[model samples]
Target: MSGPSQEVVAPKAPQRIVILGATSAIAEAAARLWAANGARIILAGRNEARLNKIAADLKARGASEAIDWPLDFVTADAGAELGKMVDRLGGLDLLLLAYGISGDQGELERNPAAAAKVIATNFSSAAAWSLAAAAVLEKQRRGTLLVIGSVAGDRGRRSNFIYGATKGGLAHLVEGIAHKLAPLGARAVIIKPGFVETPMTAGMANNGPLWAKPDAIAPIIVRAGEKGGPVVYAPTFWRGIMLIVRNLPAAVFDRLNI
Candidate 1:
Protein backbone atom coordinates (compact mmCIF):
# COMPACT_ATOMS: atom_id res chain seq x y z
CA MET A 1 0.00 0.00 0.00
CA SER A 2 1.16 3.53 -0.71
CA GLY A 3 2.04 5.56 2.40
CA PRO A 4 -0.40 8.21 3.56
CA SER A 5 -0.02 11.58 1.90
CA GLN A 6 1.08 14.53 4.05
CA GLU A 7 -2.31 16.18 3.53
CA VAL A 8 -4.10 13.04 4.71
CA VAL A 9 -1.89 12.96 7.81
CA ALA A 10 -2.53 16.57 8.86
CA PRO A 11 -6.23 17.31 8.51
CA LYS A 12 -7.65 19.06 11.59
CA ALA A 13 -9.71 17.14 14.16
CA PRO A 14 -12.58 18.41 16.28
CA GLN A 15 -10.90 17.45 19.54
CA ARG A 16 -10.07 19.24 22.78
CA ILE A 17 -6.79 21.20 22.85
CA VAL A 18 -5.38 22.91 25.94
CA ILE A 19 -3.04 25.86 25.51
CA LEU A 20 -0.99 26.38 28.69
CA GLY A 21 0.34 29.81 27.84
CA ALA A 22 -2.89 30.89 26.23
CA THR A 23 -2.13 34.60 26.59
CA SER A 24 1.17 34.51 24.74
CA ALA A 25 1.12 35.44 21.05
CA ILE A 26 2.12 32.08 19.59
CA ALA A 27 -0.02 30.14 22.05
CA GLU A 28 -3.03 32.41 21.43
CA ALA A 29 -2.59 32.00 17.71
CA ALA A 30 -2.36 28.22 18.12
CA ALA A 31 -5.53 28.25 20.23
CA ARG A 32 -7.27 30.15 17.47
CA LEU A 33 -6.09 27.67 14.87
CA TRP A 34 -7.40 24.70 16.85
CA ALA A 35 -10.60 26.60 17.61
CA ALA A 36 -11.04 27.41 13.94
CA ASN A 37 -10.48 23.77 13.10
CA GLY A 38 -13.46 22.81 15.31
CA ALA A 39 -11.67 21.98 18.55
CA ARG A 40 -12.87 22.83 22.06
CA ILE A 41 -10.27 25.06 23.71
CA ILE A 42 -9.16 25.37 27.30
CA LEU A 43 -7.27 28.67 27.40
CA ALA A 44 -4.93 28.56 30.41
CA GLY A 45 -2.68 31.17 31.99
CA ARG A 46 -2.18 33.18 35.19
CA ASN A 47 -4.53 35.97 34.03
CA GLU A 48 -8.15 34.89 34.10
CA ALA A 49 -9.11 38.07 32.26
CA ARG A 50 -6.66 37.47 29.48
CA LEU A 51 -7.66 33.83 29.09
CA ASN A 52 -11.33 34.73 29.13
CA LYS A 53 -10.76 37.34 26.46
CA ILE A 54 -8.97 34.78 24.32
CA ALA A 55 -11.80 32.32 24.87
CA ALA A 56 -14.33 34.96 23.83
CA ASP A 57 -12.33 35.66 20.70
CA LEU A 58 -12.19 31.91 19.96
CA LYS A 59 -15.92 31.54 20.50
CA ALA A 60 -16.58 34.50 18.20
CA ARG A 61 -14.59 32.67 15.53
CA GLY A 62 -16.66 29.45 15.90
CA ALA A 63 -14.88 27.20 18.36
CA SER A 64 -17.00 24.31 19.68
CA GLU A 65 -16.39 25.43 23.27
CA ALA A 66 -13.96 27.67 25.16
CA ILE A 67 -13.08 27.87 28.84
CA ASP A 68 -10.41 29.49 30.99
CA TRP A 69 -8.21 27.65 33.48
CA PRO A 70 -6.13 30.09 35.44
CA LEU A 71 -2.62 28.80 36.14
CA ASP A 72 0.55 30.44 37.44
CA PHE A 73 3.68 28.74 36.13
CA VAL A 74 5.81 30.40 38.79
CA THR A 75 4.02 28.95 41.77
CA ALA A 76 5.77 26.49 44.10
CA ASP A 77 2.96 24.00 43.53
CA ALA A 78 2.58 24.68 39.82
CA GLY A 79 3.40 21.12 38.74
CA ALA A 80 0.88 19.42 41.01
CA GLU A 81 -1.76 22.03 40.21
CA LEU A 82 -1.21 21.51 36.49
CA GLY A 83 -1.78 17.78 36.93
CA LYS A 84 -5.08 18.52 38.69
CA MET A 85 -6.14 20.89 35.91
CA VAL A 86 -5.66 18.09 33.40
CA ASP A 87 -8.01 15.83 35.36
CA ARG A 88 -10.57 18.63 35.72
CA LEU A 89 -10.55 19.27 31.99
CA GLY A 90 -11.52 15.64 31.30
CA GLY A 91 -8.39 14.77 29.35
CA LEU A 92 -6.82 16.54 26.37
CA ASP A 93 -6.26 15.50 22.77
CA LEU A 94 -3.58 18.14 22.37
CA LEU A 95 -1.40 20.10 24.80
CA LEU A 96 0.36 23.33 23.83
CA LEU A 97 2.98 24.63 26.30
CA ALA A 98 4.36 27.96 25.06
CA TYR A 99 5.45 30.20 27.90
CA GLY A 100 8.76 32.10 27.72
CA ILE A 101 10.69 35.12 28.98
CA SER A 102 13.06 37.47 27.20
CA GLY A 103 15.99 37.87 29.58
CA ASP A 104 18.13 40.96 29.97
CA GLN A 105 21.51 39.24 30.33
CA GLY A 106 23.29 42.46 31.31
CA GLU A 107 21.01 42.93 34.31
CA LEU A 108 20.88 39.21 35.03
CA GLU A 109 24.66 39.10 35.35
CA ARG A 110 24.42 41.67 38.17
CA ASN A 111 21.19 40.36 39.77
CA PRO A 112 21.01 36.73 40.81
CA ALA A 113 17.25 36.93 41.36
CA ALA A 114 16.76 38.21 37.85
CA ALA A 115 18.86 35.35 36.53
CA ALA A 116 16.87 32.73 38.44
CA LYS A 117 13.54 34.20 37.34
CA VAL A 118 14.54 33.95 33.69
CA ILE A 119 15.70 30.37 34.13
CA ALA A 120 12.50 29.51 35.96
CA THR A 121 10.32 30.98 33.26
CA ASN A 122 12.27 29.67 30.30
CA PHE A 123 13.43 26.30 31.54
CA SER A 124 12.16 25.10 34.92
CA SER A 125 8.52 26.08 34.53
CA ALA A 126 8.41 24.83 30.97
CA ALA A 127 9.90 21.45 31.80
CA ALA A 128 7.69 21.02 34.84
CA TRP A 129 4.58 21.96 32.91
CA SER A 130 5.41 19.64 30.05
CA LEU A 131 6.19 16.85 32.49
CA ALA A 132 2.83 17.25 34.16
CA ALA A 133 1.06 17.14 30.83
CA ALA A 134 3.06 14.11 29.76
CA ALA A 135 2.09 12.23 32.91
CA VAL A 136 -1.59 12.38 32.03
CA LEU A 137 -0.95 11.89 28.36
CA GLU A 138 1.02 8.75 29.07
CA LYS A 139 -1.79 7.31 31.18
CA GLN A 140 -4.29 8.03 28.42
CA ARG A 141 -1.84 6.34 26.06
CA ARG A 142 -2.65 8.73 23.24
CA GLY A 143 -2.06 12.45 22.88
CA THR A 144 0.45 15.09 21.78
CA LEU A 145 2.64 17.42 23.88
CA LEU A 146 3.98 20.33 21.90
CA VAL A 147 6.23 23.12 23.19
CA ILE A 148 8.41 25.84 21.72
CA GLY A 149 12.17 25.31 21.76
CA SER A 150 14.69 27.95 20.66
CA VAL A 151 17.15 27.99 17.81
CA ALA A 152 19.25 30.23 20.00
CA GLY A 153 19.88 27.06 22.03
CA ASP A 154 21.66 25.37 19.13
CA ARG A 155 24.60 27.65 19.79
CA GLY A 156 25.32 30.59 22.08
CA ARG A 157 25.33 34.16 20.86
CA ARG A 158 27.18 36.83 22.84
CA SER A 159 24.13 39.10 22.69
CA ASN A 160 22.08 36.77 24.94
CA PHE A 161 24.10 33.85 26.18
CA ILE A 162 22.13 33.51 29.40
CA TYR A 163 18.86 33.31 27.52
CA GLY A 164 20.54 30.98 25.06
CA ALA A 165 21.74 28.72 27.84
CA THR A 166 18.26 28.46 29.36
CA LYS A 167 16.73 27.60 26.00
CA GLY A 168 19.52 25.15 25.26
CA GLY A 169 18.66 23.38 28.48
CA LEU A 170 14.95 23.40 27.51
CA ALA A 171 15.71 21.90 24.12
CA HIS A 172 17.51 18.99 25.73
CA LEU A 173 14.83 18.52 28.37
CA VAL A 174 11.94 18.24 25.91
CA GLU A 175 13.88 16.03 23.53
CA GLY A 176 14.61 13.63 26.37
CA ILE A 177 11.02 13.78 27.61
CA ALA A 178 9.79 13.09 24.08
CA HIS A 179 11.89 9.94 23.87
CA LYS A 180 10.69 8.73 27.25
CA LEU A 181 7.04 9.38 26.44
CA ALA A 182 7.15 7.76 23.01
CA PRO A 183 6.63 4.21 24.22
CA LEU A 184 3.64 5.27 26.25
CA GLY A 185 1.75 6.07 23.04
CA ALA A 186 2.31 9.77 23.78
CA ARG A 187 4.74 11.98 21.82
CA ALA A 188 6.25 15.47 22.00
CA VAL A 189 6.89 17.99 19.27
CA ILE A 190 9.48 20.70 19.76
CA ILE A 191 9.09 23.97 17.80
CA LYS A 192 11.99 26.34 17.24
CA PRO A 193 11.10 29.54 15.51
CA GLY A 194 13.70 32.03 14.35
CA PHE A 195 12.45 35.45 15.50
CA VAL A 196 8.77 36.03 15.03
CA GLU A 197 6.75 39.27 14.96
CA THR A 198 5.08 39.03 18.38
CA PRO A 199 4.84 41.33 21.39
CA MET A 200 7.99 39.72 22.78
CA THR A 201 9.90 40.40 19.56
CA ALA A 202 8.28 43.66 18.49
CA GLY A 203 11.43 45.77 18.36
CA MET A 204 13.80 43.08 17.10
CA ALA A 205 15.11 43.16 13.55
CA ASN A 206 14.06 40.39 11.13
CA ASN A 207 17.10 38.16 10.83
CA GLY A 208 17.62 38.09 7.03
CA PRO A 209 15.58 35.18 5.57
CA LEU A 210 14.73 33.79 9.00
CA TRP A 211 11.98 36.06 10.33
CA ALA A 212 8.34 34.91 10.48
CA LYS A 213 5.12 36.11 12.13
CA PRO A 214 3.22 34.37 14.93
CA ASP A 215 0.40 33.87 12.46
CA ALA A 216 2.80 32.16 10.09
CA ILE A 217 4.29 30.04 12.85
CA ALA A 218 1.03 28.78 14.41
CA PRO A 219 -0.45 26.83 11.49
CA ILE A 220 2.85 25.13 10.81
CA ILE A 221 2.91 24.02 14.42
CA VAL A 222 -0.64 22.71 14.29
CA ARG A 223 0.19 20.67 11.24
CA ALA A 224 3.27 19.30 12.94
CA GLY A 225 1.29 18.25 16.01
CA GLU A 226 -1.35 16.47 13.98
CA LYS A 227 1.26 14.59 11.98
CA GLY A 228 3.69 13.62 14.78
CA GLY A 229 6.69 15.80 14.02
CA PRO A 230 9.37 15.30 16.70
CA VAL A 231 11.23 18.58 16.18
CA VAL A 232 10.11 21.22 13.70
CA TYR A 233 11.56 24.56 12.72
CA ALA A 234 9.06 27.25 11.84
CA PRO A 235 9.12 28.46 8.19
CA THR A 236 11.01 25.21 7.29
CA PHE A 237 14.28 26.81 6.17
CA TRP A 238 15.63 26.98 9.70
CA ARG A 239 16.03 23.19 9.69
CA GLY A 240 18.68 23.39 7.00
CA ILE A 241 20.26 26.44 8.61
CA MET A 242 20.49 24.82 12.03
CA LEU A 243 21.91 21.63 10.54
CA ILE A 244 24.74 23.60 8.93
CA VAL A 245 25.45 25.69 12.00
CA ARG A 246 25.39 22.70 14.32
CA ASN A 247 28.01 20.88 12.23
CA LEU A 248 30.32 23.76 11.39
CA PRO A 249 34.08 23.27 12.01
CA ALA A 250 34.75 24.60 15.50
CA ALA A 251 38.11 26.14 14.50
CA VAL A 252 36.47 28.18 11.75
CA PHE A 253 33.04 28.38 13.45
CA ASP A 254 34.45 30.25 16.45
CA ARG A 255 35.85 32.90 14.09
CA LEU A 256 32.53 33.68 12.37
CA ASN A 257 30.13 36.00 14.19
CA ILE A 258 26.92 33.92 14.48
Candidate 2:
Protein backbone atom coordinates (compact mmCIF):
# COMPACT_ATOMS: atom_id res chain seq x y z
CA MET A 1 0.00 0.00 0.00
CA SER A 2 3.00 2.35 -0.33
CA GLY A 3 3.39 4.80 -3.20
CA PRO A 4 6.57 5.00 -5.28
CA SER A 5 9.21 7.32 -3.90
CA GLN A 6 9.55 10.65 -5.72
CA GLU A 7 12.87 11.59 -7.25
CA VAL A 8 14.51 14.74 -5.94
CA VAL A 9 16.18 17.00 -8.48
CA ALA A 10 19.45 18.75 -7.63
CA PRO A 11 19.75 22.52 -7.86
CA LYS A 12 21.49 24.03 -10.88
CA ALA A 13 25.25 23.44 -10.77
CA PRO A 14 27.72 26.35 -10.64
CA GLN A 15 27.98 28.15 -13.98
CA ARG A 16 31.69 28.91 -13.82
CA ILE A 17 33.71 26.19 -12.08
CA VAL A 18 37.48 25.98 -11.72
CA ILE A 19 39.22 22.78 -10.64
CA LEU A 20 42.88 23.29 -9.60
CA GLY A 21 43.95 19.65 -9.74
CA ALA A 22 41.67 18.55 -12.52
CA THR A 23 43.69 15.47 -13.45
CA SER A 24 42.87 13.71 -10.18
CA ALA A 25 40.25 10.96 -10.44
CA ILE A 26 37.73 12.49 -8.05
CA ALA A 27 38.08 15.94 -9.58
CA GLU A 28 37.61 14.52 -13.07
CA ALA A 29 34.51 12.68 -11.92
CA ALA A 30 33.11 15.88 -10.46
CA ALA A 31 33.96 17.69 -13.70
CA ARG A 32 32.01 15.12 -15.71
CA LEU A 33 29.02 15.47 -13.40
CA TRP A 34 29.12 19.26 -13.60
CA ALA A 35 29.51 19.03 -17.38
CA ALA A 36 26.45 16.81 -17.55
CA ASN A 37 24.64 19.50 -15.58
CA GLY A 38 25.74 22.16 -18.12
CA ALA A 39 28.43 23.91 -16.08
CA ARG A 40 31.27 25.87 -17.70
CA ILE A 41 34.57 24.42 -16.52
CA ILE A 42 38.22 25.48 -16.31
CA LEU A 43 40.69 22.66 -15.75
CA ALA A 44 44.13 23.49 -14.30
CA GLY A 45 46.78 20.84 -13.77
CA ARG A 46 50.45 19.96 -14.46
CA ASN A 47 49.83 17.59 -17.37
CA GLU A 48 48.70 19.39 -20.51
CA ALA A 49 47.81 16.16 -22.30
CA ARG A 50 45.66 14.90 -19.45
CA LEU A 51 44.01 18.27 -18.97
CA ASN A 52 43.14 18.49 -22.66
CA LYS A 53 41.65 15.01 -22.60
CA ILE A 54 39.44 15.82 -19.63
CA ALA A 55 38.39 19.10 -21.20
CA ALA A 56 37.33 17.30 -24.38
CA ASP A 57 35.49 14.67 -22.41
CA LEU A 58 33.63 17.33 -20.43
CA LYS A 59 32.59 19.02 -23.67
CA ALA A 60 31.35 15.71 -25.08
CA ARG A 61 29.43 15.13 -21.86
CA GLY A 62 27.52 18.48 -22.17
CA ALA A 63 29.52 21.26 -20.53
CA SER A 64 28.61 24.75 -21.70
CA GLU A 65 32.35 25.17 -22.26
CA ALA A 66 35.53 23.32 -21.22
CA ILE A 67 39.17 24.49 -21.29
CA ASP A 68 42.55 23.64 -19.73
CA TRP A 69 45.48 25.63 -18.30
CA PRO A 70 48.58 23.71 -17.25
CA LEU A 71 50.69 24.70 -14.26
CA ASP A 72 52.77 23.12 -11.52
CA PHE A 73 51.12 24.09 -8.25
CA VAL A 74 54.20 23.88 -6.03
CA THR A 75 55.88 26.98 -7.36
CA ALA A 76 56.22 30.66 -6.47
CA ASP A 77 53.72 31.45 -9.22
CA ALA A 78 50.97 29.27 -7.77
CA GLY A 79 48.95 32.21 -6.54
CA ALA A 80 49.39 33.92 -9.89
CA GLU A 81 48.34 30.70 -11.63
CA LEU A 82 45.14 30.63 -9.59
CA GLY A 83 44.49 34.24 -10.51
CA LYS A 84 44.91 33.27 -14.13
CA MET A 85 42.37 30.46 -13.71
CA VAL A 86 39.78 32.81 -12.25
CA ASP A 87 40.45 35.20 -15.14
CA ARG A 88 40.23 32.41 -17.70
CA LEU A 89 36.88 31.24 -16.37
CA GLY A 90 35.64 34.87 -16.78
CA GLY A 91 34.52 34.71 -13.15
CA LEU A 92 34.57 32.01 -10.50
CA ASP A 93 31.45 30.49 -8.95
CA LEU A 94 33.10 27.35 -7.58
CA LEU A 95 36.79 26.59 -7.08
CA LEU A 96 37.98 23.13 -6.01
CA LEU A 97 41.47 22.32 -4.73
CA ALA A 98 41.93 18.57 -5.04
CA TYR A 99 45.67 18.05 -5.32
CA GLY A 100 47.34 15.87 -2.66
CA ILE A 101 49.84 13.09 -2.04
CA SER A 102 49.88 10.26 0.50
CA GLY A 103 53.57 9.91 1.26
CA ASP A 104 55.43 6.95 2.72
CA GLN A 105 55.52 7.20 6.51
CA GLY A 106 58.75 5.26 6.90
CA GLU A 107 60.49 7.30 4.25
CA LEU A 108 59.34 10.54 5.83
CA GLU A 109 60.52 9.37 9.21
CA ARG A 110 64.01 8.84 7.78
CA ASN A 111 64.24 11.86 5.46
CA PRO A 112 63.61 15.50 6.22
CA ALA A 113 63.45 16.22 2.49
CA ALA A 114 60.67 13.68 2.06
CA ALA A 115 58.70 15.26 4.89
CA ALA A 116 59.21 18.71 3.35
CA LYS A 117 57.89 17.55 -0.02
CA VAL A 118 54.75 16.10 1.55
CA ILE A 119 54.15 19.25 3.56
CA ALA A 120 54.75 21.43 0.51
CA THR A 121 52.35 19.54 -1.71
CA ASN A 122 49.56 18.72 0.73
CA PHE A 123 49.61 21.87 2.84
CA SER A 124 51.69 24.82 1.67
CA SER A 125 50.81 24.68 -2.01
CA ALA A 126 47.14 24.15 -1.23
CA ALA A 127 47.11 27.07 1.16
CA ALA A 128 48.60 29.34 -1.48
CA TRP A 129 45.91 28.42 -3.98
CA SER A 130 43.14 28.73 -1.40
CA LEU A 131 44.35 32.17 -0.37
CA ALA A 132 44.63 33.31 -3.93
CA ALA A 133 41.16 31.99 -4.76
CA ALA A 134 39.73 33.58 -1.62
CA ALA A 135 41.01 37.02 -2.62
CA VAL A 136 39.17 36.83 -5.95
CA LEU A 137 35.94 35.27 -4.63
CA GLU A 138 35.78 37.67 -1.72
CA LYS A 139 36.18 40.68 -3.96
CA GLN A 140 33.58 39.26 -6.34
CA ARG A 141 31.36 39.00 -3.23
CA ARG A 142 30.25 35.46 -4.08
CA GLY A 143 31.71 32.00 -4.77
CA THR A 144 32.54 28.74 -3.01
CA LEU A 145 36.13 27.59 -2.52
CA LEU A 146 36.21 23.87 -1.79
CA VAL A 147 39.25 21.91 -0.65
CA ILE A 148 39.46 18.12 -0.57
CA GLY A 149 40.88 17.05 2.78
CA SER A 150 40.86 13.56 4.37
CA VAL A 151 39.56 11.70 7.45
CA ALA A 152 43.16 11.00 8.38
CA GLY A 153 43.23 14.71 9.22
CA ASP A 154 40.65 14.21 11.95
CA ARG A 155 43.24 12.30 13.92
CA GLY A 156 46.82 11.48 13.11
CA ARG A 157 47.61 7.80 12.59
CA ARG A 158 50.86 5.87 12.82
CA SER A 159 50.41 4.60 9.28
CA ASN A 160 50.24 7.97 7.50
CA PHE A 161 50.96 10.58 10.13
CA ILE A 162 52.69 12.99 7.76
CA TYR A 163 49.85 13.04 5.27
CA GLY A 164 47.39 13.28 8.16
CA ALA A 165 49.26 16.21 9.64
CA THR A 166 49.25 18.14 6.36
CA LYS A 167 45.53 17.51 5.87
CA GLY A 168 44.94 18.58 9.46
CA GLY A 169 46.66 21.85 8.65
CA LEU A 170 44.46 22.28 5.59
CA ALA A 171 41.32 21.58 7.63
CA HIS A 172 42.18 24.32 10.09
CA LEU A 173 43.07 26.72 7.28
CA VAL A 174 39.70 26.22 5.61
CA GLU A 175 37.88 26.54 8.96
CA GLY A 176 39.44 29.95 9.49
CA ILE A 177 38.72 31.02 5.92
CA ALA A 178 35.13 29.83 6.21
CA HIS A 179 34.69 32.12 9.18
CA LYS A 180 36.29 35.05 7.39
CA LEU A 181 34.28 34.51 4.21
CA ALA A 182 30.99 34.76 6.09
CA PRO A 183 31.09 38.54 6.02
CA LEU A 184 32.18 38.67 2.39
CA GLY A 185 29.22 36.55 1.23
CA ALA A 186 31.68 33.98 -0.17
CA ARG A 187 32.28 30.48 1.26
CA ALA A 188 35.17 28.13 1.89
CA VAL A 189 34.57 24.48 2.72
CA ILE A 190 36.76 21.49 3.53
CA ILE A 191 35.62 18.06 2.35
CA LYS A 192 37.14 15.08 4.13
CA PRO A 193 36.86 11.68 2.48
CA GLY A 194 37.82 8.36 4.04
CA PHE A 195 39.55 5.46 2.25
CA VAL A 196 38.74 6.54 -1.30
CA GLU A 197 40.04 4.02 -3.84
CA THR A 198 42.07 6.17 -6.25
CA PRO A 199 45.37 5.70 -8.04
CA MET A 200 47.04 7.33 -5.04
CA THR A 201 45.75 4.60 -2.76
CA ALA A 202 45.98 1.72 -5.21
CA GLY A 203 48.88 0.16 -3.30
CA MET A 204 46.81 -0.18 -0.14
CA ALA A 205 44.34 -2.93 0.72
CA ASN A 206 41.04 -1.35 -0.37
CA ASN A 207 38.74 -4.37 -0.30
CA GLY A 208 36.79 -3.18 2.74
CA PRO A 209 33.20 -1.95 2.68
CA LEU A 210 34.27 1.53 3.81
CA TRP A 211 36.20 2.18 0.60
CA ALA A 212 34.57 4.60 -1.89
CA LYS A 213 35.06 5.00 -5.62
CA PRO A 214 35.59 8.37 -7.37
CA ASP A 215 32.19 8.25 -9.06
CA ALA A 216 30.50 7.44 -5.78
CA ILE A 217 32.16 10.38 -4.02
CA ALA A 218 31.85 13.04 -6.75
CA PRO A 219 28.16 13.75 -6.13
CA ILE A 220 28.86 14.37 -2.47
CA ILE A 221 31.44 16.99 -3.44
CA VAL A 222 28.95 18.68 -5.77
CA ARG A 223 26.26 18.68 -3.10
CA ALA A 224 28.51 20.18 -0.45
CA GLY A 225 29.88 22.80 -2.86
CA GLU A 226 26.38 23.78 -3.89
CA LYS A 227 25.15 24.01 -0.30
CA GLY A 228 28.13 26.11 0.93
CA GLY A 229 28.95 24.52 4.26
CA PRO A 230 32.12 24.80 6.38
CA VAL A 231 32.90 21.09 6.25
CA VAL A 232 31.55 17.87 4.72
CA TYR A 233 32.40 14.17 4.77
CA ALA A 234 32.02 12.32 1.50
CA PRO A 235 29.65 9.28 1.68
CA THR A 236 28.08 10.85 4.84
CA PHE A 237 29.05 7.75 6.86
CA TRP A 238 32.55 9.13 7.37
CA ARG A 239 31.04 11.76 9.61
CA GLY A 240 30.12 9.07 12.14
CA ILE A 241 33.39 7.22 11.61
CA MET A 242 35.41 10.36 12.28
CA LEU A 243 33.21 11.38 15.21
CA ILE A 244 34.06 8.13 17.04
CA VAL A 245 37.70 8.37 16.09
CA ARG A 246 37.93 11.98 17.27
CA ASN A 247 36.29 11.19 20.62
CA LEU A 248 38.33 8.15 21.60
CA PRO A 249 40.68 8.74 24.54
CA ALA A 250 44.39 8.94 23.79
CA ALA A 251 45.09 5.87 25.87
CA VAL A 252 42.60 3.82 23.87
CA PHE A 253 43.38 5.38 20.49
CA ASP A 254 47.16 5.19 20.80
CA ARG A 255 47.08 1.43 21.28
CA LEU A 256 45.20 0.75 18.07
CA ASN A 257 46.99 0.05 14.75
CA ILE A 258 44.69 2.18 12.60
User: Please, what is the whole-model Cα lDDT of each candidate in the order they appear?
Assistant: 0.81, 0.90
lDDT of 2 by residue, 1-258 (tens): 999999998755688998988999999999998999899998888999999999999999999999888878898576677777777778999999999888789999999999999999999999988888888888999889999999899988899899999999999999999899989888899999988889999999999999999999999898888785798998889999899999999999999998
- Estimate candidate 2's alpha-carbon lDDT, on a 0 to 1 scale: 0.90
Question: Ten consecutive residues with minimal summed lDDT in candidate 1?
Answer: 5-14
Candidate 1 residue pairs in backbone clash: none
Clashing pairs in 2: none
RMSD of each: 3.1, 4.7
lDDT of 1 by residue, 1-258 (tens): 997767435444637787878898988887787877677877778889888888899998889889898878867465677666666667778888888888666898889999999998988888888888777778888788888877888888667788888888888877887898888877888888887888887767766666787889888888877775678888788889988988888887888865
